[model samples]
Target: MKKALTFLGTMVLTLAIGVTIGQVSQADTPSAPGSADDPIVTKSYVDQKLAGVGSGGNTGGAPTGGSTTDASFKVVTLNPGQTLKGGEGAEFILRGGTATAIASTNGGVSDVTGADDLAQGANVELNHLLLTPRNDGRGLKVGSSTAYVLVRGSYTVQ
Candidate 1:
């Protein structure tokens, strides 16, 4: 009798858990412009993979990998002994921000040429760095002098 009772109790507990899970699943749901039935995981799950967006600023379970994360990228042509540089304190900024990187240049490093190189709409110039003092573009001070380029920044998309 005790064994039978134990079996019955275990069965009841399992049934209760199963029913709870079912209820919870039906309790709430998220939706996009449509209903939950037409779910659309329109968030970025791949970085540097290219498409309509970047990690989209949302991991969506995807983390940033490396320089070529969201999309395959080509490097700026550099001579054997050539080097590129940024201003003493030049930061990188993608027009419209990293989210818009898909339709535009996503994350950017200071030294390289404009965001997407010299492609159409490309605003950065990662090649041939000018090391003038006074922070000209994106490079160290050529020497210890004082000058300025005073140019606005831009991003590029391809």
Candidate 2:
């Protein structure tokens, strides 16, 4: 009886050790870096800037980072086909060449301010939002005053 018990204890220890080693090795291993075929490494800006409307004291600096949780932004010009969600303090910037404005949230209704820009060949800045996901209002629009809305800017994505 003692011999059988000894054998069983040894087997359990061996299994435990094996499982530990296997898990450790599996975690340490890395996937083969993909090349041309396997798949290589994968890899916003605000629409408007509100000037001094003459407010009292300065507001909290939280909105600048975007949503408290990890968020992303989709940017497109001449068409409203993007969504904007921000990280903590995620600020977005874009260059729409003057007539670059987006209509977000409200669809084609056009209710938000800074959604339409009359500026051309220039850059516009929009302050990040606090609630309601991101700072996008309806869809950005490119007026007839301009031909193409060139885009340039950065937003946190995680």
The candidate that wins on lDDT is 2
Residue 72, candidate 1: alpha-carbon lDDT = 25
Model 1: what TM-score?
A: 0.19
lDDT of 1 at 145: 23
Q: Write the per-residue lDDT of candidate 1 for residues 1-158, one digit (tens) a residue.
A: 99999999999999999999998997685544545455444335343356534436654543556322222222333222222343333333221111111111322233333323322222332232212222333322211222222222221211
- What lDDT, from 0 to 1, does candidate 2 have? 0.39
What is each predicted model's overall lDDT from 0 to 1? 0.34, 0.39
Backbone collision tally, model 1 = 19
List ranges where model 2 is wrong by over 4 Å. 35-39, 43-158
Model 2 lDDT tens row, 1-158: 99999999999999999999999998887756775433454420122223332343344422454444323444544333333333223334434433333334433222123553222222233431212224444223334433222222333221
| Model 1 bad stretches (over 4 Å) | 30-158
Top-TM-score candidate index: 2
